[model samples]
Target: MLSANEIEQVYWLADSLGEPGQRIDDGLFLARVAMHARELPRNLRRFLADFRASNRSPACLVLGYPVDEVRMGPSPTACNRLREKTIDEIRLEIAAILISSCLGDVFGWRLQHEGSIIHDLAPRPEHEDVGLGTGSRQHINWHTEDSFHPYRADYVGLFCVRNSHRVATTIGALDPDQLSKRHRRLLSAPLFTFRPDPSYLMSKAHPLPGTDRGGILFGDPENLCLRFDQDYIDWPDDIDGIAEAVETLRRVIEASLIHMPLRSGDFLLLNNRRAVHGRPAFTPTYRGTDRWLKRINITRNLERSRRRRQSDFDRVIYV
Candidate 1:
């Protein structure tokens, strides 16, 4: 529960960027905006309380206000000047907000591009092509992000700045209360593998460095942890056991799906371990006014445990 003043500040910040034709760099703008937004003592306490109540489990929580209220522009360059500020300024602002918001210490931030040039950014191909274009109509299968990575994100955040199509929907599959006993049993078994997609081998001109050919189905059965990509998984030749396991996971995902339509000014944060998320395919109009989302991968209190730090140059890796 954010205080009235803190909530007002968030609305004001969004309103500032809502002007037409603004080319604001999301990373820089968020960093500065967070400075003012993070100073509310009451709000900080509320955030800590909520986080503790949830057992520090990662889930989507929207701050400030909704997109319709903010009315931000459709252009990406609207606030470019704001983003051009010094890196130290940006870092300081972001760090302050996270600390005040009880989001734990800042770990890292990233700028993701969903255009033709950078389609396959993650190492796993099954997680590819999910970002909706301006107007495409493809339904993405629900799955985790780089579940194959030994150090997957503990938390993932997406802040929407612009959306022209207005039809992109992010769906998640994970509902503890709704899971069936059969689904639970299937998830409890170990019968899955992770391998680099064949396309990456040819493009990179070499084999992927950290791929595991015979990965298990569930990493932590009691916790019911899942890492699945229907498109990328290679089931063992002995099909009966593996098929049953895969089907069970699929049914559970279908049964527990949750849909979220993100708009500008809305930030969706989720626990990567507890939920598998994906978007329906959307066609990008490619017109200057296209759907653009700024993504930031975070590791809350788990940052120190993971021993990771934010990198200065945000590199785009094609996997």
Candidate 2:
């Protein structure tokens, strides 16, 4: 966490470049900030390295930009179209900063769109009206993003641009010590099965190479990690304790959850393997005032992970 003065300095630097109603050139703004905050890159990297080395609970690195309240339209311009050159420039700057500052080796940064380009984790009225997108729903339930994929990201970044709906909260689960004996046994047992959601199976980018038969969870049993989507998993027909296992795991996650809301200009980076995150359902009136967030995926250096590099380009699907 940075001090109040440091936070204010960051905002002041960003605000100095553009007028209240004018859009700041993201690229120039980032370059200027980077020049002034040269130490920031190294400091952030050290923090990430130490955090990972200690194996402590999940942490949130909130950037100091003040929330922009005036631009609360339901549907803002597409991220790519907002200020094309500036957007790409800022993205590159941010990516460079992360690579220079974080614990992991930087692979690459890819931008995701809201529709077919990225997965809308929550149900939308245009898609389905039930399940996770019931407008009034509060809890997002615990789950990893695209867990069925064997090549999931090592770290995930969410950059907020519009968050007028302060109710959109991101909750993370971190209580490893409270796992019950039953929960431990089930997590260790290979009873859970994962399959691609039917609708997602035929899509151009199938997560894993093969058809279903993916493991629902991975990592050490004592410090469990999960990759499960309730709608996509397929429990074995003969599995006797499936129901109990699911219930026990849910209980543990709910009891240990931590909530954080992202305001404008806040960037949240999380260890995908160690933490599971989800957001409360938000009412999207298509009025341009709905919550909007930009997402980026990063793969830690395989050499650093003590593993061989699979490809020159770290392949990832946005949705």
The lDDT for every candidate, in the order shown, is 0.46, 0.49
Candidate 1, TM-score vs. the true structure?
A: 0.62
> What are the per-model C-alpha RMSD values against the true structure?
7.4, 6.4
Q: Per-residue lDDT tens digits of candidate 2, residues 82-135?
A: 432333324323433333235443332122231211112322344333333222
Q: Which ten residues in a row have the lowest lDDT in candidate 2?
A: 109-118
Clashes of each: 18, 9
Candidate 1 least-lDDT 10 residues:
115-124
Question: On residues 1-319, what C-alpha lDDT tens digit does candidate 1 reach at each position?
Answer: 3456765655454444334443233435434444544444555557655853563253656554444422333334221323332332233223333433354322331222321111211112232343322223445566665565554555555555555467444555544435555655644454455654323333333324346543433444445555666666666666445566566667767776766666655555666666677666654444445555544544444434333323332222322
| TM match of model 2 to true structure | 0.67
Candidate with maximal lDDT: 2
